[model samples]
Target: MKAGDPGDCAGYRIEFESSGPLLRVRVTGAGSYAATVDYWRQILAEVQARKPGGLLLVDELQGPALTAGEWQSLVDGTRQQGLETVRIAHVKPLGLQSVEHCEIYAREVGLEARVFDNETNARLWLRYGGA
Candidate 1:
């Protein structure tokens, strides 16, 4: 099911799903740093509680609007929590700089992170265990 719009954060919606150890998150609409963090924290808590061995799939997200600090926080937090993988899917075009930054952060954190133009590919990569 989908998490209702936060209402306070430019109509952002957080959807959660679980398949065995995999946790899926879909964030839609404009969102502030605080809102994004809150959503991720909640999802992470659930993942920890479940103690899953699978990855995290984040879909339909707009990454360019996110500040570098916010991205770093997310990467660090997920890494610290020992989540096996994170795959983010962006519906819109992403700049080369943003892509490079994500790649670097993923490498630093030892998490397989990749940006995909399609949700299907992201899901496949996350499920099949690919960097």
Candidate 2:
């Protein structure tokens, strides 16, 4: 349950771990448009290569600071690739509004997405499908 190291960027960490079928991502730092896309591309590449069949956990991210275009691209990429369950966890209170917007966008793109302020709850839902 340790956090990963930050990327070359100033305020971003991308760590990957496995919890059963889920690929857990622990991201810490600012989530701007370019940096967030790069981070996710790297992680998604790994997931695509592995082709795991569980959930994708985006943990401790402080984002949706992305422009609308970036958000659309992210959602489109996920849908096009047909990634497994994707869940986002935002520990800080940075982008609640943006998270809501992203949730709606995700739904429109035919993905089931949710946001969580509590990391524990986020993990639980991702792990158990909110049973």
Candidate 3:
């Protein structure tokens, strides 16, 4: 699906494309923590149902930075939602330095996740364990 194809998805515009072993997700909207998590669960559901090799999440949501607690909660929720089995490459939203913290929290909990400033690197990491 295209980015503008959807009107609103749980208060966010989410597009998903599956290519080979990768499930590419693009999320764009003025987002909040709760709404973000809701869409994330939807993405997780798709991943669980499809059983893709990896996930590339391009998050362009504009929102206030999440607190440390919120980041931990997101990571925990992701794990609890059964995404630990797949590698996740999260494209950090512009100006969100807190994404690194999210990656750290995810790694701490044994989630195979990484954060990147651009999609190229993210895709590279997802396809191959390159830095």
Candidate 4:
């Protein structure tokens, strides 16, 4: 669907658009590990169907940071979904728990993904490799 079409996925609000170079997804609402997994699984289904050039995920979930096990599960799930085939830039506001380990693990799994604190930098990286 184009942007602004919201759907409830595991109690999270997910909106996505595929009309551009990147599939833009915005996620909001309370966060939980199970919800997070379902969120990505939905996104993975979209990616497989749409085949966008890249993905930009703007996350605004309000809750405790994911545990280490949760992060590992996420990374493994993405790898299994063949998410490494497409570039991804995930943005969460600053002051949230850092996701450096997640990024590192994603890279180790061959996923071209990065976590950013803002959307401008995320878009720049998705478009120009951060120039």
Put down candidate 4 lDDT per residue, 1-131, tens digits, no spaces.
44347888766899988757689988998888887888888789888877788899988987778877778878887766757678899899733485666777888898888898999988889888842
Candidate maximizing TM-score = 4
Clashes of each: 0, 0, 0, 0
For each candidate, the alpha-carbon lDDT, in order, equals 0.57, 0.61, 0.81, 0.81
Pairs in steric clash, model 1: none
TM-score-wise, the better of 1 and 3 is 3
The TM-scores of all predictions, comma-separated, are 0.66, 0.71, 0.88, 0.89
lDDT score, candidate 4: 0.81
Candidate 4, residue 12: how far the Cα is off, in Å: 1.5
> What is the lDDT for 60 in model 1?
44
Tell me the lDDT of candidate 1: 0.57
Candidate 3 per-residue C-alpha lDDT over 64-131 given as tens digits, one digit per residue, 9 for 90 to 100: 87778888988888766667788999896586567787888999999898988899988888877865
Candidate 2 residue spans exceeding 4 A from truth: 1-11, 59-64, 67-69, 84-97
Q: Write the per-residue lDDT of candidate 2 for residues 1-131, one digit (tens) a residue.
A: 22333355547777777666666666777677777677767666766755555545554556556566667877777766645444443333343545555666777877666766666776677666652
Ten residues in sequence with the least summed lDDT for candidate 4: 93-102
Clashing pairs in 4: none
Candidate 1 local lDDT, 23-131, one digit each (tens) = 6666666655666677667667766676655444453445445657667876777767645544443322333334445556766877656666556766676668565
- List pairs with backbone clashes in candidate 3: none
Q: What are the RMSDs of all candidates, in order? A: 4.2, 4.1, 2.7, 2.3
- Rank by TM-score, highest first: 4, 3, 2, 1
